[model samples]
Target: MYFVYDIGGTFIKFALMENNGNIKMKDKFPTTAKSAEELVAQMVEKFLPYKKAVKGIAVSCPGVVDSEKGVIYQGGSLLFMHEKNLAEMLARECHVPVVLQNDAKSAALAELWLGVAKDVHSATILTLGSGVGGGIIMDGKLQSGYHLMAGEVSYMESDFDTEKLRGEFFGRTGSAVELIKRIATKKNLTDKKDGEQVFALIAHGDEEANAIFNDYIYGLAVQILNIQYLIDPEIIAIGGGISAQPIVVERLNEAVAQIKAANPFHAAKPNIVTCRFQNDANLYGALYNFFIQFADEVI
Candidate 1:
């Protein structure tokens, strides 16, 4: 058995999983740890009970990860995670070897192994959440650039300006969180995070809602198109809580079509698709990463 964990800003999901990707036991709780030590302590407390039964642990977390060296360079909202070697930190407490991988890269590996990209040599996956996080794969292998930031699509600039900090990055604009927040603020909805209500409005073809939705889709489509031109992957999978809406992919295709029509000098547009594993992808990916990292000891 193996212990797999997918750490998010708001929650940390952990599972006791078999080598074959079958989850034996799983659970999650709010991520209230304010610092790296607290985060380690929190995981130790939860994992201690099952420590004796597991071979090792694998973790998937946000930001630029030094997978080989087990260091987290930039941890999105987990501000205290910078410069911390979580794998080393956890191993010291649990006495079990631990491997760390960037969350998006882990998700991509899972897809390549058994999910949507299994049959494709080249693919890209974008997880639209608190901020857009994703990974790129080519030649049947995960590609972490020289800087270890290849799949960091969130930092891609949507609009640039010389005057200001130019914070209009895809990570912010292309995020589902921003989409909902924009709609909620414009519609004056009581709860800004009510995505169900927001999607309901879009589903019913509310003109005001559709107006904002169109802009969001346009931005997202353009970004996808940019990626399409860059890598020209066989397919681009969209995964996240908002992706469950079903309309997102459909609308994205429509917008992509519009862009192709306007550009006229068209190339093959991206073959966009939905991700097979949504929320649970990280857990499976983490397990796969662990297996790859500790191949000698694992079955």
Candidate 2:
């Protein structure tokens, strides 16, 4: 058996799974640590009970990760993790070998291993949640650029004229969560009436909802087009809570079409599709990473 962890901004999701990626058990807890040392300690405390039962641990975390070195160059939300060798830290405490990969890259790995991008020569996996994050697979292998930050589409600047939004990261503007919050605030709603209510308004042709949603879609379309010009991947997979909605693909494609209309530079179009995995992708991906790294010992 193997233990896999998907470390997110808000929670750390851990799982026990077989070598074949079948999860036997899973759970999550708030990620409240303020520093890397504390974060490592927190995770260690959680897995201690199962430490003896598993052969190895695989972690999917945010930031620019050097998988080969087991080091995090920069942390996205877990800012304290920058420069931390989490794998070494975990191994030292539990004395079990650990492998670490960037969270977005792990999701993409899951898709490439057994999901949508399977057997594809090239593809991009975009995880759109609170903020945008994703990974790229080129030549049938994941590409972690020199800085280990390839496919970080979220970091790109969004061209917006509004003073508040001007120069904002596309990751923030292209977020479904943000769109929901924007609509909820405008519609005077509570948490319970957030995502569904927002989508419902758009579905009912509420002009304000449609305008806000269109802005979000426009940002996405520009980036998707940029990606097409850059790598021309066969498929761009979008994974997140919002991707579950069929309208997201449909609306995004419509936005892409609007942008491509009579635009000479827009020669090749993007082939966008929803990812096979969603919220649980990182868990499966971490398991797959473990399977590949600790094959001899794990299997």
Candidate 3:
């Protein structure tokens, strides 16, 4: 068995996986604020019970991670810094090998190994939540650029305004709790409780909901178009909470069709689909990373 941890801003999800890629047990905890050393100490305390059963550990983190060196250059939405060597700290505490990967890259690895991108040689996966995230795979390998920040599509310039698109959006909606605030504020409608409530309003055919959905789809389509022009992968998988909404997918497709019609490119458009693994993709990917790194000794 192997232990996997998917670390995020709000929560840290942990799981134990069998040799056959099945989760045996899983749990989650709120991610409290702490220094690098303190955080590692907390993780070691939480992971002690599973140490004897598992051979090694694999972690998926949201930031610029150096997979090979086990260093995190940045901890987006988390309380970490550039100099922290998370994997190294974990390895020291547990006396086992520790592997680390970007959360989006881990999700892509999961899809490539067992989910939608299983048969594809190249693909891109995008996660849209509080902010957009992405991963790129080429020739059956994850592509981390020179700085280990290749598939970080969120920071990509969507407008010539010099400010990042995500920064602008995130400024309005502080957390996932506030996504509806931006939607309601922009459309001059009363703020809903959450994203699901916004969807409910859309279901009722509210004009404000419709307009918000349309604008969201257009923004997403613009990013998709940028990705299309850059890597032009064989497939593009969209994941995150929004992916569960079929209306969002339909509107995104419509916008894509419009863009394709305007462009005269003879190249084949990338196949866009929803992620099959949903919220568990990162955890599964962490397990996959553990298996790949410790395959010989794991069994």
* Candidate of highest TM-score: 1
Residue pairs with backbone atoms closer than 3 Å in model 2 (clashes): none
Question: What is model 1's C-alpha RMSD?
Answer: 1.5
Worst ten in a row by lDDT for model 1? 290-299
lDDT of 2 by residue, 1-299 (tens): 78889999889999988877888899999999998888888889878988879888899999888887789977888888999999999989988889999888899989988899988889999888888887898987888888777988788886666767668787888877888899888777777337877888889999988888888888888889888889999999999888888889899898898888958667977989999999889988877777767657534
On residues 1-299, what C-alpha lDDT tens digit does candidate 1 reach at each position? 88888999889999999878899999998999999999999999889999999889899998799888889988877989999999999999999889999998988888887899989969999989878888898988888899999999988996788789675889888889988988988899999999999999999988888999999889999999889989999999998888888999999999999989998987867998998888899998888878777777545
The 0-to-1 C-alpha lDDT of every candidate, in the order given, reads 0.89, 0.86, 0.77
True-structure lDDT of candidate 1: 0.89
The best-first sequence of candidates by TM-score reads 1, 2, 3
Better of 2 and 3 by lDDT: 2
* Clash totals, every prediction: 0, 0, 0
Candidate 2 to truth, TM:
0.93
How much RMSD separates candidate 2 from the native structure? Answer: 2.5
Output the worst ten-in-a-row residue range by lDDT, candidate 2.
290-299
- 99-192 per-residue lDDT for model 3 (tens digits): 9988888988888778888888788998776677788989887888988888887666544554543334421221223456666665565555
The full ranking of all candidates by lDDT, starting with the best, is 1, 2, 3
